[model samples]
Target: MMEFFIQGVLHPLLMPAHLLLLLALGLLVGQQGVGALKPLCAVLLLSVLLACVSTLHWRLRLDLEVALLVCAMVTGVLAVLRLELPRWPLILLGILAGVLVGLDSAAPRIPGLRGHKIHMLLAGTVLSSTLIMLICALLALMLRHLLEGIVIRVLGAWIAAGAILVLALYLLRDRLA
Candidate 1:
């Protein structure tokens, strides 16, 4: 039980793509000002719930790894560009990111989780994802407040580079496999 809980907590942190996307998203949204945070977080929670339910029971067949990479790339670029999108668009972006992360994190069929109740596993997954997202957002907000804006842009560049490299590896996965 402790092991499963730890696995759940580490799920987002363990995945490079998800980690990058969450951090990039937090940075991007943090730039949008304090007013955007509430709606963005709400959408994130809703999207995660939707993904967990759908992916677990229905086995929604989508290339979620690629989708997560793509999300990371887009959010990274948005951070680098420092483009101030309207609040609504950022909310939409949050929803999309949450869904992708949820799908990627849901591993109901994994060996450790095989005998666990679906709801129990999903609850852990959701909790971990939300915790990570909030932490990322808070860290981004702190950095934004503490340092010059250029630092955030540099971080964005690094995130983008990481996403690109990961995407390349994923593309070549067939050969690597």
Candidate 2:
């Protein structure tokens, strides 16, 4: 269990793309104000649950890595603009991001956990994904409280810029190869 939990936490932390998405989500939620945070979190969690379960029997052929970069771009732009979008749109964003991350993280086994059942892997991935979102949201909340809305927008711009660079590299990789 400990192993699964740690692996869940570590994988996203170690992956730059995932890290950026998590943080960007946090910043977006943070900018949305405290009243909206809980519902957004709930929506995101539900989305992750559905996505992970869906992955057990199916994997989308969509380029998840590129999708992640795209997520970063969208979320970053939202944050940068400090858009006061309506509730449904924000919920949709969470759902989209949750599905993307869950799909990417739902591999059947971790490096040394070959004997573990697929269900176990899914649980751990869900847990880890939840943690990443929670921590990022919490940090963004703090930053918002301390630094004001402008700072959040700045962070969002940075996130989008980083995503652009990554997306470009991935798109160009085949050509380079």
Candidate 3:
């Protein structure tokens, strides 16, 4: 149980797609200034919680990785562009990213792990994911003044490029397999 919980906690940090989407969302929200933080965070939290709960009953049988990568790519591009988007769009993006993260972070079906144990695993994931998002957003906000926003843009570009590369490799691997 402890091991499963620990795995859940580390899921976002370990998964490339999850990490990228979180970072991209954080950076984009942070770039929008303090005003955008509350709404986006609220939306993200609600969406993630709902999606995680839904995963316990019926896991979506779709290419969630590809969807996550695409969301990350779009968010990264938005960050790089530094567009001053209105609050609604940012909130919408937050919701989308949160749901994807939650859906993809479902615990693997291991033998004998049932009921409360699975919930504990997902609880850890939710806690860690939320913390990571908050930390990333706060860090970006703090560094915004020091770097004249260049660092955020660079990170966003890197995230976008990385997503594209990974997506390509993932698709090719599927074909080859």
Candidate 4:
């Protein structure tokens, strides 16, 4: 914490601090634990500050990043309670999901699938995917106006950015558990 304070708004510490807070908030919701709220609030504050301070493009993309995290946590809980997919199935789902998300993100506008599962549980693959679209759309509309085909750039960046995020999650898993 002191390291982050000293580094001020621009420190690498701030992003992780923010992510950890955001993840903790999800965990608290998952467990229905009330105690985590204080820290979670702190983390969000740090993330906001970091975005203002850091020059990194990813920092500017925090809202989309956090939106994806929230959606993932929601789907994860539902997956645990309902899907019960075996480890292999989970792996396959991960692979296929990566592809779908890539498609969803990269495409200029996502087409409606008449009977996709997103309509069923209302918690299907596309539900979370839609959340990503909504957040990205808002970000794109606000950030640029050049017909940048900007959403595709964001989509690609999010995927690559997600790979890096997995490393952070790995650290969180090891350190926290």
Q: By TM-score, who's the top model here?
A: 3
What does the lDDT come to for candidate 2? Answer: 0.79
lDDT of 1 at 144: 68
Per model, state how many residue pairs clash: 0, 0, 0, 0
lDDT at 25 for candidate 3?
88
The candidate maximizing lDDT is 3
Question: Can you write out model 1's per-residue Cα lDDT over 70-91, one digit (the tens) per residue?
Answer: 8888888888887779988788
Which regions of candidate 1 deviate over 4 angstroms? 110-116, 145-147
Better model by lDDT: candidate 1 vs candidate 3:
3
| Tens-digit lDDT string for candidate 2 (94-170) | 88888888888766634665554555656766767667777777777777756657778888999999999999998
lDDT value, residue 126 of candidate 1 = 76
Using Cα atoms with residue i matched to residue i, what is each candidate's TM-score against the true structure?
0.87, 0.86, 0.92, 0.23
RMSD in angstroms between candidate 1 and the native structure over all alpha carbons: 2.6
Global lDDT of each candidate: 0.78, 0.79, 0.86, 0.33
The candidate, 2 or 4, that scores higher on lDDT is: 2
Question: Candidate 3 on 17-60: residue-level lDDT in tens?
Answer: 99999888888888888888788878888888788988877897
| Better model by TM-score: candidate 1 vs candidate 3 | 3
Off by over 4 Å in 3: 174-177
Question: So what's the TM-score on candidate 3?
Answer: 0.92
By TM-score, is 2 or 3 better? 3
What is the C-alpha RMSD, rounded to one decimal, of candidate 4? Answer: 21.1
